[model samples]
Target: MISSPDDLLRLAPDAKSLEAGRRLFYSRRWRLVGGDGQWLWGEWVYGSGQRATESAVHLTAGHFVCNCRARERPCAHGLALVLMLKNDQERISVGQPPSWVRSVQYQADRQAKPKPLKDAEAADERQGERLALMGAGVEELELRLLDFARRGIADTLAQGPEPFLAAATHLADAKLPGPAGLLRRLARLGRDGTEADIARTLGDLYLFVRAWKNRRTLPPDRHAELLQFAGVNIRKEELLARPGLEDHWLVLGTAEGQEDRLRFRRTWLRGEKSRRFALVLDYAFGEMPFERSWPLAASFQGKAYYYPGSYPQRALLPSTTPGGRPYDGLVGYPSFVELRANYQKALAVNPWLYAYPVYLSAVTPTLASGQAGLADANGEVLPLHPEYDNFFSLLAISGGGTLAVFAEFDGYRLLPLSVVTEFGLVKG
Candidate 1:
């Protein structure tokens, strides 16, 4: 299996794709060996609950397939095996294949006249164990995300740095610190208490305070990074400290990336001519499969607040806890800009505007188009427009309405609204 972290990050995570594969799973016992990234190689029991001690080689990746008669892509047996691996169950011990399995392998080998990959038959229970652990970790992180959404941003920030502080404190206690440590701590939190409880209990006391308090004053880059560490992305900022729009915004789509153990969602406003705004959210606990919750696509309107930081509307964590514990790492979310003229003007002047017209990048400026435009920027550009990339495009469309435009850049890149200014819209 392509175990490279980057490859694993890029694996597709559509549940529909896995649905058929899930059916193939049944009551059979499976032993998982190492795989190429998304691919899982293993052996399992087959046949009508007879528990055919005969081991069989199975391969599962974006989809599941077994060289058995079950015909189903991901037979019931496959689903059970995956579920077991996902739930942190026991690991499959490494050893020689049973006599029945060896005989089957011999026949297949004779027919194919091919040499098996070195150690291909060697069972690796550890890999299965890891996968199961990672699956659980991912599910936990997704649950937390939904919880955060329910709590709303104000309520989360209102906690005032305790969680962030605790995260920092936990970082300090460990001596041999690195990315793994940071990820481990996040994974621990994913399974345990609420974000609030975790913040108050874990790590150094003073360090947490410093990070919590200093977050208010940290530079944009620093603040944004800290927030990312907590698996949150920075979307928009309110440099003027204005309150966000208070309304129901629809949750559009959510996507997962192999590059970062993160997920993003889109939300749009609802109403007549309800303008679409792309808001990007992220997760960073561990190697869990992507999250899928369609009901989240409902039209929800919430206030969008602007904070003074480079990350637009994000926060940051400290390097150490209040108790002097060294800090771990964090995650980052990128902001979407139309690169249009009107948006540039708003960004430059810093005036208090209630709600203005803003359009996504692909949306044409015509009456036929449903997209909205924010404002005009310098010279002759429309300024701010939405531009979503493949990773985030789904987030733009939720419950029939669109929220944001996923861009083709890292979360840190900002699209200049000046790039999308319509010459006709500008008084040249």
Candidate 2:
């Protein structure tokens, strides 16, 4: 059986699945749940008497199978069954496997066994073809962007989104889906967007295109960034090969969103010892949950392997020490000037970085001239984004006094993520 909630969370594919499993466990709808030495069996009922669907999970051989229609392997029902067993061992009595459970165990054993590769050479050939297509797509995108520039920004906007949309579709077909999706988003920038906003968007695209074209001349780290932007993925094994830093990492905040059928989760962590910030990303498809989620406002001792880059922000937690505890005090810049200076250093390393983590010490939340902002001890104020509606909550927590705040800055405005309160860490 799994050790704890953290172990079970590690098994999940994304945050959504972990949350779903938690809900299922708390609902108290499971029955006939028992565990043998190797296998666990359970019946879960969803909805009312008539509309209810009975789902079963057969957990064995370090694997699980569920009868629920969810495409996610193991599914929420299976996770909940594990959680139930962990919470109350007496709830699941050991017994001989039932016929259905045995059948599933046999199938699971067979599926777990590795099969010989059918055509390794053919797989390599296919990969080569895909790379070639991507190269052609990049060239085409450069030409399209140049043409748009020559036609003038006003004329291109007047022509509507058809051209950009069509180009995005073509890029997707060529297997450059990341850039393609970005172009589609850019096409939606209508008259509502300010002229400066439009120019910045265009400038970013132009920079990316030029950087990709001259990638060979760029540094290794910058080249890696270009490759990532073009949809190339770096394997975990490759990242783990580098040296890892062992530190007590404080889990600060998280943001989750869905694009197409994939859920993207970004968790921010700050190393207590190293004073380095890291961004941990998790992606899941369909109803699958993320591998693991760091408990917010808690600190864990772990080894984090940083990806190769001049300003290494993305990292992978290959191994972690078991228990985590609440952090005592907030650590960061004492003033807005120091914060801006640090931001400039990070920006110099990677100009394309959109959002940067900022932690301000002893800043009073204020609303002056109908604008929300934070003023440091020195009276230096940094304006908060207008869309950040949680300032009232932050104000209440601060009680009109100076407070420590963690936020994301997009060069212009700050979006608060969490504030250190007298009671505890409060998320914005």
Candidate 3:
């Protein structure tokens, strides 16, 4: 099955493409022309009169081929086709594949076949060139930061967003997308942001630049993190070579977000025996479905491969143990104090980490001091993030009583992800 609409939105190449696809869906421009058991076909008509171009989309074997001239893979026409199938499956009817659809499927199948490997020496040479380009980008970024400091942050802000945007674009062109993305976010800091927020953003950027420069001096684990933040791709082969840990991992909660063309699904897990936390990330591109999604509030015995880092959170599940049983109970910090201590410990290893899993054994939701928050047994309260929208639902579930809840702490506030209720786990 294809991903949900929210997932599709996240996988969209960019805001413009997503908006265009949404418009197509709303406008009913896509007609489900035909389908077989293995393939679905759609015809899309854009514009009116002579300006209209009839485009066709062929979906098969988790891939889409479209006759649109658009450079984007699974272009707007294809996305519209997917949306139509998802929303109006009854409109589609089974039929034989057209000649053009068969041709497209053949081409896709041929492309899917494995190709001969490239020479190791040539691959190494290409890698070296990439590293050199990234190094040059880092140096340019350092110079830009120096200039910003010399000119004063206030003055730089007064000049508007062009300078920062231009510098970020330069970094992106040089293949430093991680830093480029950070810079782009920094550039968009609005007037509503506090002075502390601006200062913290600048500090984080400065630290990242310094870490990239002095990476060699750091420990191996820290160095791995630095490389990751600098847009360096870690090969899956390398990660798989590391040792694996087998345990009963409880799925605490899940969250999803988008970064440009990529969609990220983060599943938080806790090892019942090891009492360790791990984050499993699944990514998709342009409406592609995630590899898999973990069942919430269930335990699965699996061998997890940990990425090399001081505080290893990201993991890969290569395989799962057969006949695994669900975990009967949840385990976590009993109070906000213990949760805060764990959060601080994680940050000591990875300063850039903004979110961590936290579980409160018993906390009652309350509206106090003009904010929604939870109060532990000791009467100490921790505020919830302002963006949390399930307060009333949580209140109703708990009946204003204390309940166990899994949440994400973003340095300042907690955002509830799920709560353990008599009925089962309710996700926020």
Compared to the true structure, candidate 1 yields what TM-score?
Answer: 0.26
Clash tally for model 2: 5
Candidate 3 lDDT over residue span 1-428, tens digit each: 43454444455556787677767767655554667766767666666723333344444334556645565655676566566667867767888877777887788776666545765678688888998898899889889888988987788788887887898899989888878877776677734444565567767778888887787799999988777777777767778898988888888899877867788888998887777778898877765556665778777888788888899888887777532665654665777788788788889999767668888889999998678998898898888876688898988988878999998897778889889887777796
Q: Residue 246 CA error for candidate 1 (Å)?
A: 7.8
In TM-score terms, which candidate is top?
Answer: 2
Sorting all predicted structures by TM-score, with the top scorer first, yields 2, 3, 1
| Candidate 3 residue-pair clash tally | 0
Give the alpha-carbon lDDT of every model: 0.35, 0.76, 0.75
Worst 10 residues of 2 by lDDT: 52-61
Q: Model 2: per-residue lDDT, tens digit, 38-107?
A: 7777777656844333334544334656656565655677777777767867788778766777787778
Predictions: Cα RMSD each? 22.0, 6.6, 8.8
Q: Model 2, residue 301: what's the lDDT?
A: 85
Tens digit of per-residue lDDT, candidate 1, span 91-118: 4444555554456556655655643565
